[model samples]
Target: MEETRPAPADLRGYCGNCFGLCCVALPFARSADFAFDKPAGTPCRNLLADHTCGIHTELRRRGFAGCTVYDCLGAGQKVSQVVFEGRDGGRRMHEVFPVVRQLHELLTYLTEALALPAARPVHAELREALDRTDALTRGTPEELTALDVGAHRQAVARLLFEASELTRAKVRGRKKRHRGADLMGARLKGADLRGADLRGAYLIAADLTGADLRSADLIGADLRDADLGGADLTGALFLTQPQVDAARGNAGTRLPGSVGRPVHWAAGG
Candidate 1:
C-alpha cells in the first residue's frame, strides 16, 4: 500500500502563531487595494502589540479592505518560530519574508497536486518536490535569506503546469479561454464559465455574482473585490484562500473544501 500522506493544515495564514509579518514587513500603496500607504518594516496602525489586528472584525468597514485578502500561506509562523526562534524582533526574517512565502506557496501547490486523482501518474515526483520544499521551509535564516526563490519557483511551476494539464485533460468542450486577460470591472454576473480557462485573468472588481465556475482554472487570477455572491465554484482549480477572501460571497456561495467561508462574508453579500 502507498504511504498515507498526512492531510495538510490550512495553507492559509495562522495569525495566532504569526508575528504579523504582512502587517509590518510588507509595504502597501494607496490604491484600490489598500486604504492607506505604509512603508516597509513599519507595523500597520491597526496592528495591535500582541500581533493581532485591532480592527480585525471590521477591517473592510474601517477602510482597510486589502488586509482581508492577504494570506501568508503559513510562512509567517515558519519565519517567526524557525527563522527567528520566536523572537519576533529581527530584520533578517523581514528581509527574507517574500522568498519564504513563495516557498510555502509552492508547498501549498505541491500539497494540492498530491490530492488530485488525475495527477496520480506524477504523484511520486510531487511527493519528492513537496518533501524538498518542506525541507526548505525548515532551513536556517541565512540559507533562506540567500535563497534564489525565483529560479526554484520556475522549476516547481513546470511540474505544477504538468499537473494542471493532467487534471484538466478530460475537460473537453468549447470552453472560454481568458488567460491573462484584463477583465477588471467587467459585468460578468451570472456568467457561464464552467470548465473555462481563466488562468492569470485580471478579475479585480469584476462582478462574478451567480457565475457558474465549476472546474474553472483560476490559478494566479486576481479576484480582489470580485463579487462571487451565490456563485457556484465547485471543483474550481487553483482557488486559494486569499482569492476567496478577496471576493464578496454570501452563505449560498459554493467554495472548495480547502477554504472556509470568509469571516467578512455576509448572508446578503
Candidate 2:
C-alpha cells in the first residue's frame, strides 16, 4: 500500500494502509452492541477470513453494534505492511502481537489529536509528530522486522501527551466544574475531551459526535446525536457499551470501541 499524505483534520484519512487489525486485536462483550462475547486477540465472528467483516451490512441486526464505532488510525496497515512487510497472519509473530496492538493504540491518539479544535494552534507540531510516526511506518523490512516497537510507542505516547495537554487546557472550564450543566446544541464536535469529568452533564443534542473522548469520565452523561459517530472513546471511564449502542447514530457515527457500523436508526426504533 502506498503511503499517502496525512490530512490536517481527517483521521480516517490515515487508515488507507490498515489491515483491519482492530477487528482482530480487541475484545467485546455480548450486549446490545455485540451478539456474542469475543476475547481479545481472537478473530471476531463477523470478521471474514480475508479481514473483512462478514456481516458488514448487518452489524446492528446481528447485535454487534460496538463493532461499528472503531477506527485503527491507519496503524493496522502500517504495522502489517511496514512492520511486518506484508507478512501473512496465522504465523509465528505471536511475540510481536502486543507491540502491534500498542502501535495501533498510539495511532488512535494521533487520530484524535487531529480532530481537536484546541490543538489547532499547534497543528503544525502535531502534524510533524504524525509525519514522524508515519515515517516509522516505512522502515526497511529488516528494521520493521526487528524493531523494539514498545519503545517507539512510548516515545509517540509522550508526544501525544504533550498534544493532549495543549488540547485539554482549552476545554477545561475556568472553574473546572460543570456538574449537571446543560450543554445541548453545543458545537463540540471533534473536540479534545480526554479525561474530562462530564458526570451527569446534559449533553442532549450537543454536537460532540466526533469528539475524542479517550479516558473521559462520563458517569451519567446524557448523549443524543451530539454525533459520537466516528468519535474515539477508547478507555473512556464509566461509559458502558450498551449506553452507546442505545444512543442514536448512523453509519457515519464513530464510537469508543469496535469498528462495526451503526445500526439502522429507523429499523432499530
Candidate 3:
C-alpha cells in the first residue's frame, strides 16, 4: 500500500497499517479509565485478526474508556509498515513500540512549533530537532529500543519552552500563573491565562469559557470535561489528543494544529 504522508500536525493513529500495538504493547491498570487490568505484550480480547477492534463502537459502554484517550501520533503505522515490514509480530515489536510512541509524541509538538508564527525565532532549531527526531523514528528497532529518549527529550524541551515564551509574550496584560494548582470546578470564565505556567494543574470540570490559554504549558494537566467554549489555545504546549478529547469545546474554541476537533465536539456532546 502506498503511504500517504499526512501533514506533521495532522499525525494520528492509522490503525489499518498497524498491528494493534496500542492494544497489546501497553499495559492498562484497572480503574475508572479502564474496566479491567490488561498486561503489556498481551492483545486485548477485542482485537480482531485483521488488526481491528471488535468492540470499537461500544468501547465506552463495555468499560474500555481508556482506549479513547490514546493517540499514537502515527507511530503504529511507522512501526508496522516500516521498521518491521518483512517481519511478523513478536516480542520485539511490542518492546520497541513504547519508545517510538514517545518519539512521535515529541514530533507532534515540534511539528506544530515550526508552524507557529510567533515561534519563528526558534524555527531553525525546531527544524533541526524535528529532523533528528524523524531520523530516530526511522532507525532500526534495536536502535529505537536502545535510544536515549530522556536526553533527547530534555534537549527538545528547552526549544519548546523558548517557543512557548515567544508566543505567549504577544498576549496583552498580566499572565496568570496556575502551575500545579488544584482548580477543579473553578470558574475562570473569560480569564486571561496567556503564558500561564499551568503544568500539572488539576482543571477537571473547571469552567474556562472564553478564557485565553495561549502558550500555556498544559503538560500533564487534567482537563476532563473542562468547558473550553471560545477559549484560545493556539501555541498551547504539551496539549495532547486525550486532553482535547476529554474537554468540552465548540466550534469557537481554537486549538493547536497538532490535534483535531474531537468527534464529540461536533456531535454536541
Candidate 4:
C-alpha cells in the first residue's frame, strides 16, 4: 500500500468539537504546573458549561501551565463525536477518552514514521500498523476501555525505534546515545547533537542555546523549563507539541514543520 503523508493538523487537538474530556478525564495536582488539585472524572472549575475553559487566555498566568502544554492528539473530539456520538456518556466517556488518547498518540507517531523517506524500507509495515491503530480508534467505548493499550504501545514502539534509527543513520559523524539520560539543568549550549538518541532524557531547565539537534530522536524526552533559544530542531524525530510547549524558546529557535513553536515562547516564558 502506498503511504499517504499525514498532515499535522489532523493530529492536533480541536477543542471546539470536543466535550472537554481532558478537563474532566485527566487529573492534576497543585504544583508549579498547576494552581490547584483536580481529580479525574471531575470537570475543572475553570471548565465552562459549554465545554470550554473559562480562563483559556489566562491559563499560564493563572498557574495552569500544564493545561497549555497538553494536546489530546485529536482524541477529545474523536471520543466526543465518534465514539459517544456527541452524547455525554459521563463515566463511560471519561474512561474511554484516556484509552483513545493513548491510541491517538500512537497514531500520531505511526503517521510520522510512515512519512520519513529514510524509513521507506519499513513503510509497508508502518502503513499496516497505522491502519490497524486507526481502526482501533473506531471501536466501541467498551472495546476501547478494555483494550490492552500498553501491549499495543510496546509493539508500535519497536517499529518507531527502527524508523528512528533508519532516519538518523543518514547523518554524518557521531550520533550521541543519551537514551533515558538524566541531564537536568546541564549546560549544553551550542552542542552538536545531530542524529542523537535522546529518548526519555531528562533535560529539565537545561540550557540548549544554539544546539544543533537536527534529526535527533526526542521521543519521551522531558524538556520542561529547558531553554531552546536559538536551538535548531529541524527534522527532529517524534518531537511532540507538548514537549515544545513545556520548554522555553525564542524566535530564533528553529523547528521542524511537524511541530509549531509555543506561543509562550514569544512572551519570553
Candidate 5:
C-alpha cells in the first residue's frame, strides 16, 4: 500500500512560522477590502518586526478584511523556512514567494482530489501531478522565478476538471454550466446549484441563502460578501477557507469537512 500522505496542514498557512511575506510582498489598493494603499515589496504598516500582523485580531474591524481572508496556502512558511532557511532574502524571497504560492495552490487541489472516492478513476494521474508540483515547489529561487507557472496551472486544471466531472457525475439529473459567469449581486436564494460549474464566476454580494451547492466546482469563484446563510455546501468542490471567510454565512450554513465555519458566521456574517 502507498504511504498515507499527511493531512493538509502543509497546505494551510501557519503564520507563526512565516516571515511576514504576505504583508510585505503583495500589493493592495485602498479598496473596500483594504484600509490603505500598499505597494509591492513594501511591508504593511501593521506587520510587526517579529513577522506577525499587529492588527490580526482586529483586521476586519480595522477595514482590513482582505488581510483576514488571505491564505498563503502554506507558501509563506515554506518559503521562509524551507526555501530561504528562515533568513529573509528580501527581494529574492519576494520574487520566489508568489511563484511557490501558485504551485502550492495546485498542490492543494490535487491532494484534495486524490482524497475523493469519486475521483479514483484519475487517482494515478492526480498523484503524479501532485508529486511533480511538490517537486517544483522545492526548486531553487532562480528555478522558481524562471518557471512557467501558467502552463503548469493549465495542466493541473485539466486534472481537476476531470476529478470534478467524476464527483459531480454521481449527482443525477441536469447540472448547470456557468463557468466564468458574471452573477454578481444576483438573487439566487434557494437555488439548486448541485453539480454546477461555477469556476471563476463573479458571485460578489449575491444572495445564496438556502442554496444547494453540493458537488459544485467553486474554484476561483468570487464569494466576497455572498450570503451563504442556510446554504448546503457539503462536498462542494475546490472550496477554500479564504472563500468561506470572505462570504457572509450563519450557523445554519452547512460546509464540507475540509473547511471550517468562519468565526464571523456565528455573529450572523
Candidate 6:
C-alpha cells in the first residue's frame, strides 16, 4: 500500500492583493474544458476588465473546467500589490505583463516543491524560500515593480528541482526506473509525487484524486479511475487528453497538454 500525503491548507485566500494575473497570464483552449481559446499575455474572454472572470458562476456550464482548477500560490496578488504597487487596471499593462507572468510561473513551481515528500525533510528550507518569496511580494513598490524577475525565479527553480529529486528517491519500487510501471488500485490519492519518474506507469484505479504530480514524468501513464479531481499536474510530461477522459475527474482537476475538459461532467448523465 502506498502512503498518502496530507492536503495542504488553503493559502491563496490570504493573498487578496493580487490582480488576478493567472486569468490573464495563462492561455486556454476552446474545448470541453473552456468556452473559448485564450492566448498567453492576452486577457481571457471571460475575464472582465477588472481582472475577474466574467463567467465565474457558470464556468462549468460554459465548459471552462480547466480555468476553475488553477491556483496562483498567492503570487498573483503579490505581483499586483507589491510589483505593480496597485497600479490601476487601465495603466501600462503591457510593460509589466511579462514580469507578472514569470512570477506566477515561479510560484507554481515553489508551491509544487512545498508539497513533495522529499522536501518534507527539508521543509524548513522550503518554508524559508516561501517566506523570502512572500517578502519579495511585499517589497516596496519600486523594488517589486522592477523587471529583473527572471533571475529570481531561476534561482528558486533550481532549489525546487533539487528538492523534488530528493523526495522521489524515497518511494519504494520507484527506484527501479521503469519506463512504465503497472500501478492499478494503488491508492496513491493525495501523494506528494513531484518530479517522480512515472513514465508510462499504469495507474488504473490508483485513486490519485488530489495528488501533487507537478513536473513528474508521466509519459504514457494510464489513468483509468485515477481520480484527478483536485490534483495539480502542471508541467507533468506525456499526459494526453484521451487519458484524462478515460479517467474520473471533476471540476477541480487541473491538467497538462492543453486538453479540453470532458463535457459529460456538466450534463451529469
lDDT against the true structure, per candidate, is 0.83, 0.58, 0.84, 0.92, 0.92, 0.62
Q: Model 4: residues >4 Å from true position, as ranges? A: 1-7
Model 2 over residues 34-148: C-alpha lDDT tens digits? 7888887777766776777778777756776566554444456656665677775542333344454454445445655666665576666666666666565556544555777
Number of the predicted model whose TM-score against the real structure is largest: 5
Query: Candidate 5's residue-wise lDDT over 1-269, tens digit each?
Result: 57334358888999988889999999999999999999999999999989988888899899998988999999998899998898989999999999999999998899899988999999999998988999888888999999999999999999999999999999988999999999999999999999999999999999999999998999999999999999999999999999999999998899999999998878778
| TM-scores, all models, native as reference | 0.91, 0.51, 0.87, 0.97, 0.97, 0.52
Q: Order of all candidates by TM-score, from best down to worst?
A: 5, 4, 1, 3, 6, 2
Stretches off by above 4 angstroms in model 5 are 1-6
Better of 3 and 6 by TM-score: 3
- Model 6 regions more than 4 Å off: 1-20, 23-26, 39-45, 49-51, 89-128, 139-151, 174-195, 198-247, 250-269
Q: Could you tell me which residue pairs clash in candidate 5?
A: none
Model 1 per-residue lDDT at 44: 86
Q: What is the lDDT of residue 198 in candidate 1?
A: 89
Native RMSD of candidate 3 (Å): 3.7
- Give per-residue CA lDDT, model 3, range 129-199, as digits (tens): 98898888888988998999999999998898788778778877777878789999999999888889887
| Residues 19-64, model 1: lDDT tens digits | 8899889999987667899999888888898999988888767787
Candidate 4 lDDT tens digits, 1-269:
45554466757899999989999999999999999999999899999999999999999889999999999999998898899898988989999998988988988999889889999999888888888888888899889988999999999999999999999999999899999999999999999999999999999999999999999999999999999999999999999989999999999999999888887788886
Q: How many collisions between residues are there in candidate 3?
A: 0
Residues 1-269, model 6: lDDT tens digits: 33222122323422345565666667778876677788877777666766677888787677876655554544555556655567754334434544554554454446666666656776666666766665565555456567478688667756765675676565454433434777888877788777677756898778887888876766457775567778888766435445666677777777774456766545431
Clashing pairs in 1: none
Q: Can you give the lDDT of residue 86 in candidate 4? A: 82
Candidate 6 local Cα displacement, residue 235, angstroms:
19
